[model samples]
Target: MADTLTSILKKLLNQPTAPFHEYHVRAQIEQYLLDVPNVELSTDAFGNLLATYRKGKHKSTPVWALGAHMDHPAWVKVPGKTDEWEFLGGVPKNLVEKKENIALRKESGDMAPWGFPVVFEDGKVHAAACDDVVGCAIIVAVFKELSRLGLDATVHAAFTRAEEVGFLGAWHLGKHWPFGKDAVFLSLETSRPVNGAEMGDGPIVRVGDRLSVFDHELINVLMRTAAEQGIRVQRCLLDAGACEATALQACGIRSVGLSVPLGNYHNLDDDQNIVSEHVHIEDVKQMINLIVALVATKHDGLGERTLEERVNLRMKEYKKYLEIGNAKYEEMTA
Candidate 1:
């Protein structure tokens, strides 16, 4: 595992956080970023942590965002039972029944990655909130490296909330989006293996999912970056469920998704036991490096090529044939 990633994940994977109750996780993020120059941190009205880098860029340069949901499937609240809270999000009943060693969020105290513990073994990282904490942790890692390198890119990150239920936090930010309308947003994820997606095969440049198709331009840039830099990648449409990118796109932000294939998605094991969700450590590391590649590469005229420039130029190659053939065919027409 990358040292920076390991350090961040170990500290974050154990926190009793739920939608609208993400103070602990937010605190950890803020503390880690306090000394990071050229960055500003703030929360939206909905408590979505926003990290915007102040790096310089030109009009042609890309001003984009990388994001992940802050909340995962969790106990709703545990007031009366004193320690037992009702389940929230999309864990099915059969899986809930399979849980034998379910720990109380109260007992977790500090280490509470929704409900499971962080485990490292055989080049894999297993934890309850690996779904998007992996995404969130990578966001921190990307921002740190980009700031250090001072890439000529304007990048920002939004750690959203309540995506497991619906993209509520994403919606709230969209209403008052600080990133300009033209900014491309990429939703980082840890998705289940599907549509040829697999663990340890490197991260995916998700084209779309159950909700809607993503922006083609952003997807192309990501794919080209990975290929040019030799970062292993897969292209897939993970339709199992909708992600935050879906909500943001619905709100009119140019958005797409990227992910590392996960095991035990949402912590629902094959036999329905509540267990740790896992992902390849190398996949995580590569995804971070790929993002740096995205920021470092210039896209000066990427989207500027007009339809005429592409199609009309090809038409010219055959223009003389049309001219010469027309005169010869006119006699036949008569």
Candidate 2:
């Protein structure tokens, strides 16, 4: 599985220009999904790959969707010579500068590296494609784990395309598909700095995003589950960026974003900014645990609690701590 993860990352990095060209990254994932049992796969008009693993003895149980965007920003080729393709400027400077054996396919569709140092060991180069590819890998990993454990509700995985280009894939899916109006939606994206989800820190329970706030009942369930399971998790909100969950929320679907802490996100000026070695297997394990809990609760029905309700519950807990501090102050005065 570790080697498979590496291979998926390498494959994505190799196709930096058009990450969603169907035959490129999509073909690779399609092949991988074939190995798992009880999986039904299909694609939408907008190229959103949907994989469903039905759980429960009956098919009428509520369905849950786990979304992850598979597309990354890349330089698209304009009409020109194969070797003379213009740098259309979507890649981060750090990736372009540090990329080994950097290649380009011009409007003619011919491929050739720009002739720098082509870094190919068994064959792989470091690049920015890992941004959401890591997310895709996590979704696949969770699916495999859930299948092994035998889940109870139908768990649907949607690998949407064109997330970098204004969340086009998610918009289409949420608008057209029947994703269950009340289904629990979780988007696996990259987390923020400092308070972000670290690679070894376990799965992040995102409280809110740039677009919309998560369902409070779902957040509380995840938080309580993590605490009880002794899993490391961080609560965070991205200030400058957005995820597929944002688009879903805009369409009135309850969603939350989960991310593994990433180092170099969109900033391309410095190679050091890129995540060096933070990706850890332990974090992935905890993520699997959270997914399992959610899948197991298919029959429990979506909780009636609201975001305000959960916030008040937290405030009550905080008040106790405040009272302790007040008592300490009074004793000191006496």
Candidate 3:
């Protein structure tokens, strides 16, 4: 299983991708999942690929849509200029000022724009585009496993575009909201670590991003699922940047986030040199396991315990003390 998962991730991480130019990445994902049993794939009006897996008699309510973008920060060909290329997405300007041997083509005669090479070595994924390609690989693995097991549930995997520029695909999907308001959107990402979150610790049950906090109930659900399955996971706010969850949440859908800690983010090292981004192999594996566990767990009202219900439960122990104190105070006043 580890070998198979690694192969899938390697294939995806090797695909050339950039903001608004995710054709190669999308094609690779389609090849992985197009023929899986009990799964249906379709491209939305916004060009986001949506794959739905359905099986059995019982279905999990308020469906789970695992989402990840297919693009990373990379160079793209400028229009009408044979030799001019423009970089897209966010990479520090200081790092690219002296662009000398920074960009390398993967193969002879490969016509894709400038990007770093991809390699998986020493139990780490070194690539020009690990930011969300790792996230895409996770979704593919989860969907394939679920389809093979034929779980009595329905879930969707969304491969979005242009997340590096902005959450453009997600924003459009949310505005249209094909799955209605009952679904929960989970944005899977490979994010720069912050707030003590470290690589190799495990996948993060992300609490929030720089923009806004995620759905409270959905966050509780992820935490509860991780605990019950004993899957080690970190919980933190990756405030260095925002993810697609912010876009979906703003559009009035319940959205949350999950991520693996990333190093040399956007292919920029601590010394501001262009290099391949990397992530821990163990963290990637754990994230896959955690998401599968979450699907098997029951979701009906799992994390919907209201604040009122919680207060009432605690009040049982403290109500008598409050009553006695109130009576003594009234007697003294009289």
Candidate 4:
């Protein structure tokens, strides 16, 4: 058989990177896509890497800007001993103290872990960085596939930075996102499992998170695409953590979040021990498939109205009946 996604996922997990310091991970992605002739790579002020892929012949209407943050929760070196550093991001301190085998990325790029593998595989590949690196890997894979297939469509994939702390990279990119105003921004993420979203249930078209709701039309577009393609998918309001979509939407961009349900989110197990985070390997694979399907879907296929808008229109259609007493229900008859 071809190479298992497990192996590819492990490679992505082992790429040591920290917030505001995503050079190594970004370089790895660049190397992966170096030979993709249709792709042009560039960097922004906040150190976000933007990969733009040009369509060859059958370009789809309305280009899509795919986003995935490059950084996850990691430790940053302090002024003390070179090995000593402050654990940054939202993984929780109680578990930080419980963390045993850990690793440090040295100045020259060598990593020394404290006895634990970057990933511990039982069934799924479990590691610390799956949160958004999975997002990065998925985007790069989609970009390459689009190029290799010669699918005529423009895709702007951005590997953003410092998302765990705050949406610093997205906020900066939002101010002057190079893809014109109409370009749809769809963010990919690995979110804590909950809210009807489970690891093996396929990718989720996020309705919203804790802070704000996503674009209804965009969510509809993804769901409609999955349906037409017969791709397994779930829709949920993933409120466990906010994603980059919210930050970009704040800038008046039409943004939405697509996530894979993650186990042991942020590496905090049920007992609060620092352990491996995982998503169903199939979830990762299906997410990539969904990305390609969504991009290929035509604007007309997505429909012109949001689900909420369509439902409200139906309610309005019968408003006259309620006013005039149709007598269809006991309340109306009374």
- For this target, which candidate reaches the highest lDDT against the unseen true structure? 3
Q: Least accurate stretch of 10 residues (summed lDDT) in model 1?
A: 104-113
Error of model 2, residue 102, in angstroms: 7.6
Q: Give the per-residue lDDT digits (tens) of candidate 3, residues 182-202.
A: 578999999999998998899
How do all models score by TM-score? 0.88, 0.71, 0.93, 0.84
Q: For residues 1-334, could you state the per-residue lDDT of candidate 2 as single tens digits?
A: 4335455555544543343433455776787777777788898888888888776664322346888777655444445644443332245555555554134222214322222121333323334455566677667766766677666457788888877768888988878765565465778876544444444556677777666778776676667656656677887766546788888877777777677665445423244332322244455456767766666654333544556778999989899898999999999999
lDDT over C-alpha atoms for residue 133 of model 1? 77
Supply the global lDDT for candidate 1.
Answer: 0.78
User: What TM-score, to 2 decimals, does candidate 1 have?
Assistant: 0.88
Root-mean-square deviation of Cα positions for candidate 4 versus the true structure, in angstroms: 4.5
Candidate 4 global lDDT? 0.77
Provide the lowest-lDDT 10-residue window in model 2: 111-120
Mind giving the per-residue lDDT tens digits that candidate 4 earns over 1-334? 1223555566777777777767778888887777787899999988899988876554455568999998877767764567666666886666564535243223333222122245545556676678888898888778766766777777788899988788999999899888886687898999986776777889999999888999986787788778877889999999978998999999888999899889888767788666667877778788888888777656674545766788999999989988667656766667
Candidate 1, which segments miss by more than 4 Å at Cα? 1-3, 58-60, 78-84, 97-115, 301-310, 320-334
As for candidate 1, its clashing pairs are 14-111, 14-112, 14-113, 15-112, 15-113
Poorest 10 consecutive residues of model 3 by lDDT? 105-114
lDDT of 3: 0.83
Query: Model 3, 11: alpha-carbon shift in Å?
Result: 1.0
For all candidates in order, the CA lDDT equals 0.78, 0.62, 0.83, 0.77
| Number of backbone-clashing residue pairs for each candidate, in the order shown | 5, 2, 0, 1
RMSD to native, candidate 3:
2.4
